[model samples]
Every structure is written in C-alpha cells, then in structure tokens.
Target chain A: MNKSSAPRQSLGELLPKLVVAPTFVVAVIFIYGFMLMNAWLSFSSSRMLPKYDWAGFIQYEKLFANDRWWVAAENLFIFGVLFIVICLLLGLFMAIFLDQKIRAEGAIRTIYLYPMALSFIVTGTAWKWILNPELGIQRLVREMGFESFTFDWLVNTDMAIYTVVIAGVWQSSGFVMALCLAGLRGVDDNIIKAAKVDGASMPLIYRKIIIPGLRPVFFSAFIILTHIAIKSFDLIIALTGGGPGFATDVPATFMYTFSFTRGQIGLGSAASMMMLMAVIAIIVPYLYSELREKNNEH
Target chain B: MNIKRVLIYSILGFAALIYLLPLVVMVITSLKDLDEIRSGTLLSMPQALNFDSWDKAWGAACTGVSCEGLKGYFWNSVLIVVPAVIISTVIGALNGYVLTKWKFRGSTLFFGMLLIGTMIPFQVVLLPMARMLGFLGLAGTTSGLIMVHIIYGLAFTTLFFRNYYISIPSELVNAARIDGAGFWMIFHRIILPLSIPIIVVSVIWQFTQIWNDFLFGVVYSSGDSQPITVALNNLVNTSTGVKEYNVDMAAAIIAALPTLFVYIVAGKYFVKGLTAGAVKG
Candidate 1:
C-alpha cells in the first residue's frame, strides 16, 4: 500500500505544476523569448528578413538620422502629452460634475462611457468621416451658411496628429472619468462637509482638498494613458493612415511600416525596442510602487 | 440653485450630443443611398431608408480579390474568439487555482512574471512571433492568429482569475483535500463550479478584446483568414474605387456590432471586469 501510494503522492504534487507548465512555457518563449529575439534583431543588419550578423547599432544610427522616424517620434511626443493632459482634465471635470448627485447620472455616465467599449478602429473610422473636409462636418457647416468655416485637420499634415489626439480623447476620457469617479466616491464625506461648514466655496474645496487627495488616481490614469498613447496604431491607421504623408506616424506605426512594408527590418526592430523601452520606463515604476504597496498591506 | 441646475444639465446635454454625434452619423450614413450621401448633409436623415448598404457591407463588398463582404472575416473572428476565449479562460482558471490554492515556492514570482508579460508592448513580440509562426508552419493561418491571441491573452485572463480566486476562501479547498479529493477533482468539482461569475467576466472581456483586435489580425492572418477589423480597414482604405462612404460606414458598424451588443447586454460585468483589471494594475 505504501509503495503504491508513493508514486500517486508524487503525481499529486506534480499536477499543479503540470497544469501551469504550458502558460509558464508560453510566457517564457513567447513573451521573454520574443523580447530577446527583438533585441537581437535590432542590433543585427537585418532587412526584409531578420539577419543575425552583428551590425553594432547601424539601425539605431539610421533610425535617429531618418527624418520620417523623427516625425514619428515627435508625433508620439505631441500625441502622448496632449492626449494624457486633455483626457485627465476632461475626465476629472466630468467625474466631479457627475459626483454632484445630479439626476440622470446613470444615463449621462453611460453615454460618456460607451465609447470605451468600441474599438479604436471603429472610433477612428467614425472620426475619419466626421473630420473629412468634403464629406463630413466641414461640408455640413459649409452648407449651414458658414461658408468660410474650415475644420479639415484630418488631411492637414500639420494638424493631423491633433486629430488623432481628439479621437483618442473621445474614446478614453470616459474611462478616465470612471477612474476619477471611483476616486471621488472614495473621498471621505465628512471632510467635504467640514470644508462646507467652514464656508469654503465648492471650487475651493475641490482645488484644495479633492483634487489633492486624488493624486493616486491621477498617477494611475497617467500611466494607463501614456501606454495607450505609445501603442496607438489602429487609430492612426484608420483615421489618417499616418497621413498627409506620414506626418502622424507614431513609433508603433513606424515600426509596422518599416518592418513589414518597407522591408527595413533592422530599423523596424530598433523602433520596436525603443517602444519597449518607453513602456518599461513607465511600467517598471508603476509595478514597483504597486508591488511595494501590496507588500506593505501584507 | 435653479440656475446652477439648468446650467449643469445644459452642459451635460451638449456634451452628450457631441459624444453621440459620430455614432449617429455612422448610422445615418449607413442608411442613405450613395447619391443622397453625395448631395445631402451628413447629419441629415436619409431621404429613403435603405438597408441595401448593410446587405452590401455584409455580403457583397469587395476587399482585395474577394467581393464577399465582411461575412467571412466576421466568422473568422467568431471561430478565433470562441475557442481562444474558452481555452485561455480555462487555462487562466487553472493557473489561478494553482497559484492561489496550491501555492508553492516561487509562485508569487511566476505570477509577477506573468503580470510583467501583460505590460510588455506587443510590438516587442511581433517580428519574433511572425518568424516563430513561420517556423511552426502556422504563419498566415487562423490557427496562428488564435495561438498568438491565446499566448498574449493568458496574461490578462490569468490576472483576472488569479485576483478573483484569491478572494475565494481556501478552507473549501482544504476541506475538499481532506475529503480525499485530488487536484483535478477539486478543481473540476469545487473550484470550477464556484467560478461561474469570473468565467463570465473573463469570457466577456476576452471576447470583446479578441474581436476588436486589429494588429494581430493584420499582421498574422492573411488572404480569406483575415479578421473583420483588418478586412474593414482594407475596404475603407482601398483608395482604388470611388469612395463608398455608405458601405464603409455600414462595414464599420458591422465590425463593431458584436462587441457593442455584448456591451449593451452585459455592461455591468464589462465594467466590473474593466475596473478589476485597471484598478489592480
């Protein structure tokens, strides 16, 4: 009986490991393994297909020197900053407004939040029509006796990136609103009452106490928005096709076009590495803080 | 006070209009005939309610060499999403079960690694994945896309189930074990039965994500196996023919309809899943 039970006991102990092994293997190979291959490809002189020859940062050199790459990098900076800032402000305002115990809060909140459920592809295509000079808002307004009115940012190279920011904010501001609302609801009611009793204005209360207390929500929103901004591909693709001539290409789109279409695999891999670095820069700090907080709780 | 209430309501109503305008335009344009779309205002109601555009967008619109609308791509999404969601969710549940209930040395470390996987940009994995898929003879196949999604999706599904199962009491598992139930038995009988809510949340979340995904669809799948998002994009951006704004809008709506329906029906669980994923992250 003891001999028979020994192997069965061992199998019992191994079952969990067996169950988890596939995910573990996938995580190792697909995630970490691919990441390392990307790093390797970035350093090699690969084009059209990945080559293993050591190239010593030639791709990085070319990427930095390339004007289109510079445009993409600059576009990312503009889109990232404006998208995060606008979404945070708009989301916070909406959250605070809704938190005023207003009637029809549920309906209004749903209206704002519904876009979050839609894909960026859909968001982009819809906004594309709306922003089109001839077929959309511009034409509508032009026919509305406002003949000189112009809002043709979609096709305007200088203004196309801002169009992306606009669509992005529309899709995500509700999410930010939801996050801030959750933070607002968690605020101590007594404190707000105390401020009210002290004859503080509502704006003053919000500025001094409420906003200050929601710092963590702000942090969380910023991190989430930053990453979204970085990985923004489909929106730009559908809305502008990074267009009026690649004026709105962010790093993600740049990577795709170069690696897949342009056959500059080495350059594309380099861009991908830069994107990965940007993500890691944001994520590592966020994870460290999160894990530290959890450890403290434990 | 009355003025304040009116001001707030008016502002909110205006904001709501702005939010609804694009969707309204999409629907209106989708209903209008091509000539009316050309002459009439974009915001105007269609002169004649036309369902032909919807029919065209679904079955007759051309993408590349195929004139079949988004129908095939839609089914491709369904095939890819259903199996991927089920398999990934089951794996996630199992991983969550073991990580929490059958805790071992370095389990937290493994969980941390998985969490890190969630944060890594998919771009990092793109080239390597394409190459890897090619090596496995799965490149440009639906199975390849499904595999890619499952691999990427495991991080999220695992995160969801792990966080949820952590809240489940361990005493139940302890009792089951003492009653001579083994690992798989306890999981199937005790844990899986208790996991319905999280499973729903996981399914809804995964379904929406995989359905909406464009990057992997465009990159991995090719020919007729392309998912709807990619096909819709191709149809919209094709640039060769006269721009069929109506067909494009209809196709966009068709591509968006599944997730939209899911959201409208089970929005509560969707919000729960979003908050659980976001707040914890």
Candidate 2:
C-alpha cells in the first residue's frame, strides 16, 4: 500500500539471500514439492515403486473400499472428539486449581506439566504395559483380592479406542494446562477482585468469569490436540499397532501400512490425500477464526 | 471452607497420580523377573529386583543374526538426531526471524505453506518421500532419516521462534539495522541470545521427536543405520516363539529413558515452551 517507499525498501533486497534462501529452497523443494509428488503418486498405479503410469480414481476407490481405512476414519473421529473434550476439561481444571494461591504451587505445576516433554514412543509403550490386562491395572486389582477384576480395554476390540483416548489425554492435557494456566495468569487480577467483592462463589467465578476469558487459549489447545489426534501414529503403533484386530487403527497408521508394509503405494497416497482433506477441512476454518481473533486483540 | 482447600489439593494430587501411574508401572515391570511380571500385579513390588532385563535389553536382544541389544542403534540415533535438531532448529529460527521481521510480500503465504507441512501427517507423504529419497540415493540411511526429521521439524520450530520473535519489539531490529549489522550478525548476536527460552524449547521438542520417531527410522533406515525406535519396534512388536515380557519392558524403558530424562529435567521448560505460543502470546 505504501508504494512511495517501495524502491527505498529494496535497498536491502539482497539481505534475505543469506538466511531466507536456504529455508525457502528446502521448504519448497523438500516439503511442498515432495507433497505434490505424493499427490501425483496417489493418482498413479504405483505399488512399492515409482510407476508414473496413469490410474485415476482407482487408488481412491480402493482406499474408500478398504475396511481398515473406514475403521481408521471412524477411530480418528472417536479419538479426536474424546481426546479434545477430556483434555480441555482436565486442562481447565488444572489451570484453575493452580491459579489458586496454593502452597507448593511451583512443584505441583511441574508434576502436572512434565508429560508433554516425553515422546509418545516412551509414553505409548508405558501405557501399553500399564493397560495390559495381565501385567497392568486389571491384574493389580485382582491381587488386591478383587478376583473379578477385568479392565482389558487394550485387548478388547470394542474398547481399544478408549485406551488410545486415555493415553492421549494423559500425554497432552499437561501442555493444555500450561496454556490455560498462562491464560489464567494473563487474566486481569482486577476482575477476580471485583468477583470477590460481589461474593461470587469460586465455582461460579471460574465457570462464568475465568472460563470465558480463557476461550481463545482453550480453542488453540483444542485445535492443536485435534491435529495431534488426526495424525496420531506413534501411540497407536507403539501401544497397539492398530491392533486387537485393527480396532484402534487410525488414518496415519493406515497410510503407513498401505505404503510400506502392504506395498500399496497408490492406495496409501490416496488415503493420505483424503486424510489431508479432512485435516484441511477442520483446520482452515478454526485457524482463520483464531487468526481473526488475534487481529481483533491487536 | 478450610476442608475445601484440602479437598482441592487432594483432587490435584490424585490427578497427578493418575498421570504418573503408567510411568511407575513401566519402571517396575522393567525390574521384575519374567515369572514375577507374568503373575505379579502391575503395581506390585518386584519379588526380587533384577538388573538382568536391563542388561538383556541393552546388550542381548536379537533382531536377526545379531543378539546385541539397543546399543547398536543408540549411536545411530544420536548421529541422526543431533544434526537433525541443529539443522532444523537453525533453519527454523531463520525462517521465523525473516518471516516476522522482514514481512516481505507473500510472507504470510509462505508461512501458510510451512504450517500446512506440519499439519499434513507424515505417513500421508511417506510414499512420495520414499521415492524422492530413493531417487536421491539417500534412502535407508542416516542422511535420509535426518532429512525427513528436518523437513518435518521445520513447521513446529518455525512456529516456536516466530511466535517468540513477534513478541519482541520491532525497534530492536530497526536499531540493529541502523548500526549497519547484517542479517546473520544481528541474528547470531542479538536475536539468538534473546531466544534462549524458545531455543531451549525448540531443542527439547525436536530432540524428543527425532529421538522417538519410529516410522521415519523404519522407512528411511536399514541394517546398522536404524535408529533405536526401529530396533525397539522390531524387538517388542514382532512376537515370535515366546514374548519376553521382562526384556520387552526393559527395552521399552531403555528406548524411552532419554526423552524421560528430558521431561524430568526440563519439565518446566517443556511446558513453558509449548504453552509459550498459546498462553504467553
């Protein structure tokens, strides 16, 4: 818009070459360029090889018809919703509780927030062991003289999705807590003082005043977690391998199996494109609103 | 009213316990004998504490012809991860700095592409990535894996630094430019020092991601070049004659220890790093 300054600003035209060129080149060629290649592969009759031969919609058809693909789609939805909701609730509660002027707050905060540092490779396997029917909670309860104990969700096809949800919530809720807690910190202390003057109950104050104030942070947390849910592979692969007969399968793993293990590159690419579309559909609107909100704040 | 405070503390404590329970189980199972692990409760004390499984996991578990444990791939992971972290984070920081400070035309679109790269699941891009790597003669090597990590790590690292950079006053860069400092000079001296918090965050995030990555390792590495996660996967995932529960648990713990250490040590920074963008921003 400032056309008069355009030539003057070009005085530094060569500056970006030092830093920007390397980043731009890598990002474009390796990332976007490869992505285009992937999209092309999806449309071709490739199978464990680079078959540039044309084969439109065939891969897509197979991708849609595959039971595993359908299961993965369903699993993504179930896990995504559950993971987002529970993480939000737990994160909010932790943030609010930590906001209270409590003793040992720093230490407790660290304990609540440590999980985000560890990768799912570790946490997922730990969860797998902990949720194992024979080695984990079920057996632990049985030894306590509760012989009727049976919490084998990891092995149960119908309930394996919940197992993924549990581990997911555990891993991510801490990060969400940190976000909400920071938002809580940013909340003007005056508002709380005003609430106290009005004799608002703690729960009422949190529910009405704090929660609403924290909505943007909450939304950001939700969006990030939703993306994580959609792209969840490490946890599923590590803990269950989409196992107990593909009960906990997700799109990410489906993509992997088709592309690598099963040697169905075209189908895998098609499945991935579908997953990409799903992610874009969900993310674009949420991100637009979030950015708009930021603009409004500024 | 006094009791309610106790109740709140208790609830928080209980929640923390739930979160920590699995980690406790993992450590315990690693120390237990197979018989004890088989019959023992997950939360139960080991009948006899043993280091055998740890030794076995580190040095004795077999993948094919070799019975050497995760130690073989340990160096491979390190070699791959260190460079991958440094390269990606450095590039990411530069990307962040240029995008936010420069704000050239189409900068937002460029950023949009970077973010899109992050959101697209890695597996979705695996087939083409494999082909590309194969064509480049980098497939199934440490270089290939490092390339993958850098590409994947770009989005998040850029995100971390960009959000942090935006928080800095623009006047700093302007003033530096007035002093005739070039991009690299300003970035290296001024911007990087100021970015300690976020750099720590970026390093930790990238380290854990690269360290724990299994899919990339499996697809991009072979033979002695496989990272620990791939070895760990092969060890635990492929059940043959009889599953060695103790060794498996020990191997899992071994595979996870580095990241676990990062969490326990930099736990505060980790949360701070992640929440820095959403909460602090």
> Interface RMSD (Å), each candidate?
1.1, 2.2
Candidate 1 structure lDDT: 0.91
Query: Which lDDT tens digits does candidate 2 get at residues A146-187?
Result: 999899999999999999999999988887888888889898
Candidate 2, TM-score of its B chain: 0.91
DockQ of each: 0.78, 0.60
Report clashes for each candidate as comma-separated counts: 0, 0
Residue A159, candidate 2: Cα error in Å is 1.8
Instruction: Please state the CAPRI-style docking class of candidate 1.
Output: medium
RMSD of each: 1.9, 3.8
Per-residue error (Å), model 1, residue B207: 0.9
Docking category for candidate 2? medium
lDDT of 2 by residue, B66-115 (tens): 67988988889999999999998898888889988878777788887777
Chain A only: list TM-scores of all candidates.
Answer: 0.95, 0.92
- Expressed as tens digits, the lDDT of each residue in B184-241 for candidate 1 is 8988898888889899999999998899999999999999899999999988887756
Judged by whole-model lDDT over C-alpha atoms, candidate 2 comes out at 0.82
TM-score of each: 0.97, 0.93
